[model samples]
Target: MFAVTILGNNSAIPTLDRHPTAQVVTCNEQLLLVDCGEGTQLQITQYRIRRSKLRYIFISHLHGDHYFGLIGLINTLNLMGRTEPLSVYAPPELEQIIQLQLDCSGTILKFELSFVPLLPGYSGLILEDKDLRVSCFPTQHRISCFGFSIEMQKRKRKLIPEQAKAYEIPAAYFSKLQEGADYQRKDGSIIKNDWVTLSPGKAKRYVYCADTIYDVNLLPWLKDADMMYHETTYLHDLEDRAAERYHSTTVQAASLAAAAGVKKLLIGHFSSKYTELQPFLDESRPVFANTDIAEEGVSYIV
Candidate 1:
């Protein structure tokens, strides 16, 4: 159930078919929105996403394309009678921005909202929940920016049914076995937990490189990800311009993904200059196979 749905993928502006940067990361039943670009609320509605289950949000930067829709989403949540608490992770200055917007509009939310600042000169694990763990790292962008790594932890241990049955363990106790509990017979004999259970399998990870210039320093964060989303704001031909503007090109993004040995790559945040995007694929697939365009409505399973 861990997947990421692309709500908006364009770089600097909205387009007829494309949108600015925003994504919904579904970790089982819980949802962590990565960014809230303009019109993100409508994008959620159009894609049939359940906004009610969103418990946390991570804004990568202060760019309007990254978080301009936060106020609108908060207002709408209040209108919908939401009572659950929501936490937002972003720079320290975002608190003042949100406060100003709410104060100026005389808007009061019906639910609790908290902010966790992603400060400069610091980067490490930021969140650990029942289903997922998230870490943040600084990225080289025009403004202060951070990238997120969402890893889905395996919950249940593998059950060896034959081993359990040989130990006379009852079927009703299997759930307990999966929870790493040993069995005890009526005769007061103990059946060891390891006799019937194995460790949970590997955890799957999804990394989002919000916006950045071409830099090899990101390899550590991108390493061994089950899937990764890196912005390809331009085609390979615009390499010079991309470097000057602090955006990445398709070839640069693909090279990093390939070097990191990620399982799959989802590239988006296309510059509005190019109306056609097929060239991005044509250029990136040479460097990394399994490269995909982050289309607005498609969900890429991590």
Candidate 2:
């Protein structure tokens, strides 16, 4: 059940048909909100996301399009009487920004809100829970920004029922076997766990290359990811403009995805000027066949 749902795919400005940059990553029962741009609360309601299960929020940068809706969403959650603690990870300045807004408005949240500051150029493991492990790396953006690498961990070994039955192992001990523990027979004979259970499958990863210009240094973080989300703010023809704005064009995004060997590529954060999205696909698919538009309200499984 590891998946990411696009909330607002547009960049900078909200269009009639598109909003700003926001996404929700579902890791088992928990939800991680990434980049709560303006109108994000409404988007969450529209998509019917379980707000109760949202435990973490990751903001890639301080751009208004990336985090302007944070205060509003926090207020909404407090008004809704949410009691669970919510952790937010972002740049150091964001803590003061959010605190100032809360203080001036005399708003007190009912839930415990904690902030973890991501220092400039810091890159390493940021979070690890039972279901997911998240790391962050610096991206080449206008301001200090970061990209998230999320890995879904498979902790339990796969049990071979036939092999277990052949070993005369009781079903009561199957759970233990799946936990990689040896089983002892009534005669005190040890049955190796590997004899009846296979190792857990490789972890699946989703890398979010948040708001970066085309930079190959990200290859180490993006390599071999199961799914990667990279912003294609403009068509290939706007490559120069994209460079000027510290953004990426469709061809550049596709080329990086191809070079990194990601299983699939989700491209979004479109410029408000683009009305028809087909040109983006038309320009990207030839360069990388596995690219898909990160359409709002659509869930992409990793």
TM-score leader: 2
85-190: candidate 1 lDDT, tens digit per residue: 9999999899899989889999888899999999984589999999999999999999899999999999889999999999989899999999999888999999
TM-score of 2: 0.98
Give lDDT for model 2. 0.96
Compared with the true structure, what per-residue lDDT tens digits does model 2 show for residues 2-119?
9999999999989988999999999999999999999999999999999899999999999999999998999999999999999999999999999999999998889999999999
Q: Candidate 2: worst 10 consecutive residues by lDDT?
A: 101-110
Q: Where does candidate 2 stray beyond 4 Å? A: none
TM-scores, all models, native as reference:
0.97, 0.98
How many angstroms is residue 182 displaced in model 2 relative to the true structure, after the best TM-score fit?
1.5
Tally clashing residue pairs in candidate 2: 0
Cα miss at 30, model 2 (Å)?
A: 0.7
